[model samples]
Target: MRPRSCFVRSSLLLCSTLVFSGTVARAEAPAGPQAPPAPQAEPAVEPPSAPQVEPAPSAPAIAEPAQPAPVPAAPPATPPLGPTRPKIDVYVTAYGELQFAYFNYGLDQNRAGGAQRDSRIEFDTNRFVIEVKGGLPDYGLEAEVEVEFEHGGTGSAMELEYEEFGEFDQELDKGGEILVEEMFLSKKLGANAALAVGRFYVAVGTLSEFSRPTDYLGTNRDEAETSIIPNTWDEMGVRLRYKFPWGLRLTGQLVNGLDSTGFSSQLWSAGGHQRRFEVQRATDMALVVRADVTHFDGFTFGVSAYHGDTTRNRPKADLVKSCEEANPREVAPCGYVSAPLTLLDAHLSVRKGPWSAKALVMYGHLKNAELVSQRNARLSNLLGVIRTPVSDNALAVWGELGYDIASVVGLSDSHHLFPFVRYDYADTQFKPREELYDNPRFRRSVYTVGLSYNLMNVAFAKLDFGHRRLGSSAFRPENTLRFATGFNY
Candidate 1:
């Protein structure tokens, strides 16, 4: 009876659980189509949100993975390099002149009786020069080179030599020259100063300072300065230059001195320039100082001085004084005699409006000139020189004034016609020692009048007439007519 009761209870519980599960399944199943529900209004006050929950899956779908961030591209490759050149500035320029002249005087005026009545005509390519200027601005360095072709460069002439009584021979004469007028390197010390070294013009006269054809008014260079000193006198040396804000410039130089063996009455020290040998002698030295003031527009004034010892520059060192008690064992040139040369000059230049003028006064002195003359007289006949007694002093003065008639005659500025007048006086033997005679033939005065035509200072033509008078009235006066044409570029 008990076992039957337990079995009936178990069967009833199982039946109840199966009926509950069936009911749940029926509630969760999808319903048939029904009418839409109405929308409800949102709440005025928001309530706190529940924790996030994942949505239940309805169907399978395909998806792609996230992509990585992009990277930037690299720059283009660089090219290989080549050699780098230095930065330098360079310039080149040239100028030249041709001249024709007629003179009523002998070519050899220093003859015994002086030139009488010989007329002549001449044509010359006076000079041609090329200039090169270079600069390394980064280093404050500059260089200049000037090459001059004079009288058509170089030439040779056949000459008959008869110095010895019974011997006659033919010789070759050096007639012209090809010269290096200037070659120098300079370093700028500061904004207002510079230093230079090498061969350059000596700063003792106006010619050396202003050598361009357009710088002066005459057809030829100043005769006065040329008679006493080397024309465009150049020497190997060192130079220092300084400038002041007030338009003043100062220059100083140390250079080789002139050779005294070539000194003579006719040319004074003009021939002392060292050009006879392959190398120049610098046993003696010279000092030069120059000052120039360009305070005014188109006007300038200056002064310069030079001093040098000359005796030691001779070829053989022969100009020595004999010792009182000479010994055979003593070497040559026991004691050298001192002969110094001193030169001074003042110059002025003005070019205001239609007027232009230039003036200069130069004087030079020689110490122990008597001894130099005596020794020069005894030189070998082969040494070409005047063989005349040199004076102790020399003087030179010259002035030129010109008016640009182009404006006066209503011509354009591009065309210039200048009517100029010039006066020159030079005395190679101004004063002499008691033992020497001062030849009056060495003194000269010249008056010149000319017309110069130029096209903007680049090309020019000149015609001039001059009358030259000797110191003594008994000597015949000389006259000259000259024509010149040149380019300055």
Candidate 2:
């Protein structure tokens, strides 16, 4: 074979081998004309044609219709839909406690009023609470609702005001009671300001965190506060709060005041929570203002004031006859008077490492209690007893200190054991109107020492012994033992 032909064949073979493996083939040149025609014949053919015919009349020109608009390509199909966040975010939490008490069971009690007024043991479901919080970012608002089941049943608490002068009597706990502790809607005013409206805790005292069993250090709340102010007091109204970046905050509220008619010489304003109906009227609104300093870590100092009119807090129609008949010369008519109530309180809280402390002092002034007492004297209820010579001033002071022994000893951080002591002294009759009888029972002091232990921070147990002293050295005091357990989240 010729060399060129041999080269061609080798190249073709190589290409064929690669073709099976996806090689692209190249184009080849056309072959030369196989034969050459005679040139003379071409010339002779060219000379034979001469005649040409005229073209036929051209057909009338026709215009083409306008082309239709081009259709657009559809947008790429949207990615498959995926899960999305909800419009409103919801959170839930709960807290509750159970307790047992051995009242007036001290050695002294066993000797004096043994088994009678000084010795009694009882078990109780202290309080069960449910809380719900919700936030809506699009609307720039938040809401919260807190409900409490106190004492434990629907037939729960039947507190007869006449049960005891200065003690908590479980005899009223036939079943339990339910209360809507707080329900409020707050609008964000700015980065550090907010306005809330609806039923909410009053911002007057330390217990504003609430009088919950879990909020306080001891087994019981400061007697001074619970006696003069509503425990966990909540009222329907509006609150405006502004906070500074440095940890100072100012809060103010406008809410319903306590009812003078419900107020007693013993509990002062505690029984004045008007729960007679679904909605509480705001006819007698009160103003509460509070200022707090929290610039220091783990320390808080606060002051609060409350001023309100109690005359309108009561039902004039119901007590009109009682006041008309009292006919007292030293006091005004029963049903109507300015009877403004003013309260002031200052509190301090310190939590430095393993040491914690709390202290508070409060005073309440009532004008025209002489007139209010005149009305209460004639009024009687299973829950209320008329104390003559109503007090014009009420004062309370309490302090507590605790140290975390587990932490101090370098035990597991999750476990805590704290030994604490607290002293509370409250007297509603600090100053009484002349001619009004001041009972020493109302001027009592409490001393408490306890140990509280927590496991894993979810549950806790508490044991405490308390002593109560009444009426100078003449009247013997009472003593009690308390055990409590609770859980929170």
Per-model TM-score on C-alpha atoms: 0.79, 0.76
Candidate 1, pairs of clashing residues: none
lDDT of each: 0.82, 0.75
Best by lDDT: 1
Candidate 1, 1-489: lDDT as tens digits: 644443444334434433533433443212322311101111211122311212213112211223444678888777558755558999998889999999888876655555767778999999999999999887889999999988885743223244654222334445567888899999999999999999999998888877888878788987888989999999999999999999999999999999998898878999898876556788899999999998899998999999999998886657888877766675453778899999999999998998889999999999999999889998766556577888899999999999898977888989888899999999999878777776789999999999988889899999999999888876778899999899998
Model 1: lDDT of residue 370: 90
Task: Tell me how candidate 1 scores on lDDT.
Answer: 0.82
Candidate 2, position 391, lDDT: 79
User: Which residue pairs does candidate 2 place in steric collision?
Assistant: 153-175, 153-176, 156-175, 156-176, 160-382, 160-383, 161-382, 161-383, 161-384, 389-436
Off by over 4 Å in 1: 1-84, 110-113, 155-174, 324-333
Q: How many residue pairs clash in each candidate?
A: 0, 10
Clashes of 1: 0
